[model samples]
Target: MFGGSRRVRQAALFDGASLPRKHISLGGWCGPALMLGKLGLRTEAYPFDFSRVTLDGLMHFIQNGFAEGFYPPGPPPYRPECVGPWVLFRGQHTAFAHFDLNDPRVQAHFQVKMHRFDAVLDAPERPVTFFRTVTARHPQEELALALDLEEAVARRNRSLDFRIVFMVHDQGLRASAVQLAPLSPRVSLWALRYRGLPSDTLFDRTHTAYHAVMLHSVAEENWSAVKVGVVPPPPATMASAEGWDFERNVLVCDGAARTEDVPFADLTITRFPWRSHDNLALIDGVASVGGTCTGIGSTKMLANASAALHVQRLARLKCRYCGDATYHAAGRPFRTDRPFTDEEDQLVLIHLYKILTGGDKVAAVEKLAHEMRRGTYEVICRIQYLTNSSTKLMDSFDPNSLSDP
Candidate 1:
């Protein structure tokens, strides 16, 4: 999506004040023709096109060629010097890379940078009134003291050494403060370690020796995992139709309706157990899955039934054959002008029978519907009703019945 070819044309202008007499040379023609050839264009057409090209047109073409090469590949790699406030140093091999700026080992390390900010009190602004009240009780030695009473333990012994231990008890409390003030609590401290001093000394007699001091802080910004590539799910198939078998507790469409064998990157399956008696389906247990079956065009009863039962639920419940519409439960139909036909009634009856019998005839009907391209219920109902009517008509004229009358 990022890289593609482009073409541009530019015009040349000469000012009388700058150049008293100037003839614009066709220098632009040479650059474009050479570039086009390098980009896989044929050199033979160069002369024919070049002669007709204007200086402006030639300049535009060159600019277009440069634009095509501007967008390269993925983003440039991270440079440590260019890194900002916080650097996300992920474990490369097993060893943790040093954050020392001078360390070459850290130079090649892959890290993500982030920014942070903090505030300090303006100590110089305090007036003599506030300073006197705060400093009046403290001696000059106490005021200049760098170590607290606990830190003075170093003065009693020389062999004793102190260690700074840092533990990240929790990673959740690292939020930036809204404002800075003298009374504002220090959220966390920088632990310091040193050797003991002499009993009479004001400072530690032993020089401080430094070791690794873990700096624990949280990013001031949100971070998200960078997605590389994703493999999608396989396309739907007949096996997926097992999901639609509610009696088996597999209430999904098993994808038996797909005609093509091509695989898809992703597929979604849903269950519709309550769709069996859905009013939208002229024949129950069948409802269009995606959209209405109207545009499917002059299909047989089997196609319509399959679409309703297997493919999707109807967007609207208009008869596929006659366009006689039905309401969605309590909703009004577009028009109630047309009455239900005998064919529709028969289809409905057969579907009702199947429901009543706990789908006893479903397997046989499904097979027939698929094979004949005529819906099983509709065809069977028409035949049964016609035969019964004929039998009744014949019985009315029976010799025994006539004698009794």
Candidate 2:
């Protein structure tokens, strides 16, 4: 019923992070996005990755926050500039655009200080090469004349010493390139954790945009009505199982726990990072959405983790009694192993979701249980616990409801 690809690692990392399985949603970016909200960063969510729906989803929450105030409120209110969507499509004009640097709107919408489309540090040895690299997306008269586009941007911004966010793929993984990128200040280079992009797009510079598949599953819902969390559809994608799993690419930005390369992790300068599942338990602020500037499905960092753990953790009260390690007690091999497959997990999720959201539907749960290969009784017991627990939690005022705290 559900389909998406997010493979897990051979071993899990539960060290230091003792988060209750219930609080974490594994697999998809949806789980990670929800996890971010749980961490109090007040995530402004975007669905369909780089599609128009993504922009619509963001605008939906932006206007919602303006109209109804952000759910799980905080002091000073949540603003768009303080938040970055889970991903962005840089090739889109409006998607990656910055208004006139001097305009009030620019400060209102974005954090960038430069007015031009490109920002570079120091003069380049090969200005034409640099021009081709940076200005591939921009068709400017000044660039055609072979002007020092980098210098012009610097002069226009009135700052020679600045930061460069030069993002690349695994092929661009030269430590020397980092030092060569910017002459002053510091350059925060983003390297994709995995290298599985299209043949021509080994390194994403200009002209990089999100594919149309970004909005494939979402069409019925009004983008404006959605919040910055998991979208509709009872069970989130395999993203929860594969895409959001902490053990996989780790959909949730469990902070810099997954960060490497630099002697010390720099939140201000690290590349696209997904953390261990337990990483978020140690953090106290909004997760840095990272620098994946394309569709949602492509990012390993935004997907990942255990199948049994995912179901038990996310199905609310109905999931409370589900035993994940029971197979060991019964002298049976573990059902799921490293490098998870989505179809089987989808069955588990479908059965559990029926319990979580449709507690009254006895036939539906039974029907799903009947369809499964084994362990039907255990599934029923767990779902019953989840339903009862969820009812109790829903009937009370809870502190966990305070998202920003």
Winning model by TM-score? 2
Candidate 1 lDDT by residue in tens digits, 231-327: 2221133244322232442223213322122222211111101111111111122211111122111111223333344321122233343443321
TM-score of each: 0.14, 0.20
Q: Worst lDDT window (10 residues) for model 1?
A: 127-136
- Write candidate 2's Cα lDDT for 1-405 as tens digits: 011123322232222343311111111123222222333321222321111112222223222322221111122221111111111111111121111122344334332312111222233211111101111111121112222323444454454433222222222221211111122222222222322433222122112111111121112232223332222221233334322342332233213323333321221222222122211110112221221122110112222234445431121111111222211011121121223236645664565665456342323333443345323233333444545635221121121221112
**Candidate 1, which segments miss by more than 4 Å at Cα?**
1-359, 385-405
Q: Model 1: how far is 278 from its true place, Å?
A: 21
* Prediction 2 TM-score vs. true: 0.20
Model 2 Cα shift for residue 160 (angstroms): 15
lDDT (CA) for every model shown? 0.21, 0.24
